[model samples]
Target: MTPRPGVREYVRLIALGRPPVGWRTTDVTTWSLARLAGRLIDRLVVPRMSRGTLRRILREGKVS
Candidate 1:
């Protein structure tokens, strides 16, 4: 099975999707890192991400 990207990776890519360059990071503290992780799983990295094993990949601390 393949792996998924992390929160920092997600944020980095999504941020990279934007222009001007300086608006890369965010301060969204309302959401836990896990929730951000889940969002990165479900939204950005799913379907093309292989299987439905985001939680396992995350717990394993490995990202493709």
Candidate 2:
């Protein structure tokens, strides 16, 4: 099982000079660290992501 690339990972990729894949500029612009943390909690509780997706993100260090 892997985890999906969450908001923080997406943001990190962008910060690393990578282009946006499935995310919008507003999505990154509007997110604060606090909001990202909250969303992480939500994902943990709600289980919206599959483990494979997250594993890919971890292994690749970017969203594909």
Candidate 3:
């Protein structure tokens, strides 16, 4: 999207969004290393993103 001029303009910027979910089956306090920016970007339905590009987006958005 390259909407970094002010990414917060593209979508409602949730600087820190929800975290990943985990299911230990025996515990619910376990979380993975999922540093996935916590909703830095919305998971679009029309197109999917590649890790590399997402990284670039993060770099451009200065959210990295």
- Candidate 3 C-alpha lDDT tens digits along 1-64: 4344454333223323334454222333422223333334345421343455556655555754
Clashes of each: 0, 6, 0
Two-way lDDT contest, 1 vs 2, winner: 2
Q: Which has the higher lDDT value, candidate number 2 or candidate number 3?
A: 2
For model 1, how does the per-residue alpha-carbon lDDT over 1-64 read when each residue is reduced to its tens digit? Answer: 4543464355445433333222233644243344444555657564343223444444454432
By TM-score rank, best first, the candidates go: 3, 2, 1
For residue 28, give model 3's deviation from the true position in Å. Answer: 11
| lDDT of all predictions | 0.43, 0.44, 0.39
Q: Candidate 2 lDDT, tens digit per residue, 1-64?
A: 3333475465345334532344433435444334433444554633454444434444466433
Off-target runs (Cα >4 Å) in candidate 1 are 1-29, 46-64
TM-score of each: 0.28, 0.29, 0.38
lDDT of 3: 0.39
Q: For residue 11, what is the lDDT in candidate 1?
A: 48
Q: Which ten residues in a row have the lowest lDDT in candidate 2?
A: 18-27
Clashing pairs in 3: none
